[model samples]
Target: MTVIAFLGAIGPLVFIHELGHYFAGRLFGIKSDVFSIGFGREITGWTDRRGTRWKIAWLPLGGYVKFAGDMNAVGEPDAAWLALPAADRARTFQAKPLWQRAIVVAAGPVVNLALAVLILAGFAYGYGVDRTPAIVDSVIAGGPGAAAGLRQGDRILSIDGRSIDSFSELARFAQIRPAEQVAVTINRGGHRFVRPLTIGVERQRDRFGNEYRIGRIGIASGSPVLAPVGLLEAPIAGVRMTGGIIRGTFDTLGQVISGRRSIEELGGPIRIAKISGEQLSLGWAAFVWLVAMLSINLGFINLLPVPMLDGGHLFFYAIEAVRRRPLEPRVQEWAFRGGLAAVLALMLVVTFNDLGAVGLWQRLAGLIG
Candidate 1:
């Protein structure tokens, strides 16, 4: 069931990402030689009328679209193919303008982002969001809220100058910044005032014995309400939600890079499979929500400025646009090799983390002892 769930969730995303590149190439009249659903040995395939060999390969990790006049899936120009007649060259990816090539390389990640936004928008339009005012009914004695002079009937207006509409939003903001001081804006008798509030922290452990630190302000909710969003507002809400996720991801990565967070928090395919199966057991809603979040992550990761990635291709294109020529072939090749090494190292680290998460390393150590 776990295997099936993982495949079901990941397969379509890979296909869609490759399809984006294929369509973009077609749009510019560039012909594709192969459209593969995976890398390596072909399990099965068929040639279309346009002579593109569509195939499913043995590995299900990732896929690619191989365009004409290219050396391989990486889209480097093949010397022999480049030497073909002008008529043939005109229909190849390498024959296109730098701007066109940039668009083709960028289309994959953009489609993933669009897919995430549409999924979130559909959920908003179909079910709507829960809404409640950030009104304080009571404050816990000796807690952060009481220490900050928060009292009953005071309405929380914002946190750190960012306006919040509901108690849920306020909680979310505070939860991420445990032990940090933030400016709390409150509305009392229609007049607003800001106060410096140090959020109280609590240590929590999950069923898996994973510990987490969360913030508390010690305020109780007054009332709760469900708000139905209009059709026109749903897409806007989706975009806003996507933007927030992106920003949060950046923040987390920044912390990890700065040594303020542990890199063990990262996971790979094994972790994704476990989570996908868990979400499937919960219900389709939870599963699809996971998909939407993963889609956003997929899009964001692909846009990072690293070689052997779509973003790397775009980076080269940007340099080409500036210099009026592409980099030397040998230099580009070495950069791609370095990029591949970096990507593989990251995969190894994440896989090790995933194994540790599942207690595999501990079990192995027990046997060794």
Candidate 2:
């Protein structure tokens, strides 16, 4: 079951991710030679009338598309591809308009996000949702919650005197009320604590020089019972879920970047398998959350400006857009090799860490005895 689920999760997620790039490339009128859902020798395949060979490969760990003049099966341009005639190279990726190339590069992550949103919506509609009522899990140390006189285990009764029956409402109040002082009412123990507190919101900068806003209440809470809202309500919940997951992901990334967290905390495939296994035991709701969380991670990771990644491709596109020409093919190839090496090293490290997290090394230790 664990193996099945781990395979299932990665297979579909990867397919959808790559499909985004493939479809978007075609949408912009780029030609493709192959659109495979997995790697290695073909298990089953069909040639479209247009000569695109679609296949399900044996090694299903990941999949990719072969664009016209793709230097590699993964759709990257190669040196030999550069030797092709200019007319032949027109169908090549490097020949595409800068904007079209960027869209093709960006679409994979975008599709992952879209799949997550839809998954969330469907999950919410099927199983209902859990929301936290205006509840204080704990007061932040000198943070807004603490400054507002919130107490330990206090259920946030209201914020700014607005009646909030749900934590969603309280959270909305928190996000939009950035840097504003508000009266917070909480039930601590058997007593109520009310304090006027000035709340502070955190700010983050993005790749495009855009900024994002977030509430800075340093605490956690139990999810309230979200009785099944109507079908219409689930989509809203899903959208909110997507946004919240993205926000939390960015916060964690920021922490990692700012040295507030250790890189050792990062996990790779082993961690994902363990998590998927655990979620399988917990049932579908847990499974869906795992999918959404991983989907976000997939989206974010692909958007990273690494040379062999979607983000890396986009970075080149950005450079090309500025320079009015693509990087020299040799330069791009060398950059890709360096990036691939870095990626492999990172993978080994994360896999080791993940194995440690799951006590696999320890288990093997016991086996050695």
Candidate 3:
């Protein structure tokens, strides 16, 4: 079940992402030599009339589109391929204008983001927004809400001047603003007033042993209510949801980099596979929602200015635009090597964390003991 769910979830994402780059390259007359859905040995493949080898590889961690004249999947320029005849060179990726190449490089992540937005929009259209009012049922003593004069039966009106329609909205708003002071408005006894409070920090551990630090305001909600979304409003809701996810991701990463959050919170392929299976057990809707979130994360990660990624190519193109020529091949090679090392180190760390989350280390120790 785990393997099946993981493949089902990641297969479409990888294919769609590579297709984005493929189509964008085709638009500018650049030919792709390979369109692979994985990194390693080919499990099965076929060559198309256009001469592109479409394949499913053994390693399912990621995929790539290798354009003609590129040294590898990262799109590094190949000197030998560059020396091809004029007609052959014309259809190669390196032969295109710098702007065109940049677009082709960026198309993958952009398409991933677009996919997330479309999925979220479809969900909003089918189901509605959460309409549970932000009514406080209880407030824990000595907590942030209690300290701020909040009490039972108080209805939250807004936070930081933004209207809060549901308890979920209020909770989400507070969760992202951990330990930060915010003005929250509430109505009690038919009178409304604004109260400033510093949201408390809470460290929580999930059943999978993954830890997270989130904001806690010391209040609980009654129950959830669903409200139907209008056709016209669904797209807007989707865009807003995607934007929120992007912002939250940035905030979490910033905290991780700053040492405010534990690095154990970062998970790699193993954790994703486990969660994918769990969500699949819950039902298709939950699984698809998880997929949308992962899509957003995929797009954001690829856009970072790290070498060997789409953003890296764009970064190089930006420099070429300024200097009117590409960087020296030797320098680019060294930079790519460093980028590969950094990426590999991160992967190892995340994998270690995932193993720990699953209690692999403990099991090993028990056997040795």
Q: List where candidate 2 sits over 4 angstroms from the true fold.
A: 40-44, 79-88, 126-149, 152-236, 364-369
Model 2: residue 112 alpha-carbon error in angstroms: 1.0
What do the candidate models score in CA lDDT, each in turn? 0.86, 0.77, 0.90
Name the better of 1 and 3 by lDDT: 3
Predicted structure 3: lDDT: 0.90
Can you rank all candidates by TM-score, best first? 1, 3, 2
lDDT of 3 by residue, 116-195 (tens): 98899899889887778899999999999999999999999998888887898788878866898889999999999999
In angstroms, how far off is 308's CA in candidate 1?
1.5
- Highest TM-score: give the candidate number: 1
Against the true structure, candidate 1 reaches a TM-score of: 0.90
Can you list the residue pairs that collide in candidate 3? none
lDDT, candidate 1, residue 130?
58
> What is the lDDT ranking, best to worst?
3, 1, 2
Candidate 3: lDDT of 345? Answer: 96
* Residues 1-369 of candidate 1: C-alpha lDDT, one tens digit per residue: 788888988889888888899999999999999999878999999999999999999988788899998888766667687688898899988889999998998999898888898889888888886577899989999999999999898999888888888888888777766777889999999998898999999889864465677889988887677678788999887897788778778867886788755799888999899888878877899899888888888888988889888988898888988999989888888888888999999999999999997789999999999
How many pairs collide in each candidate, listed in order? Answer: 0, 4, 0
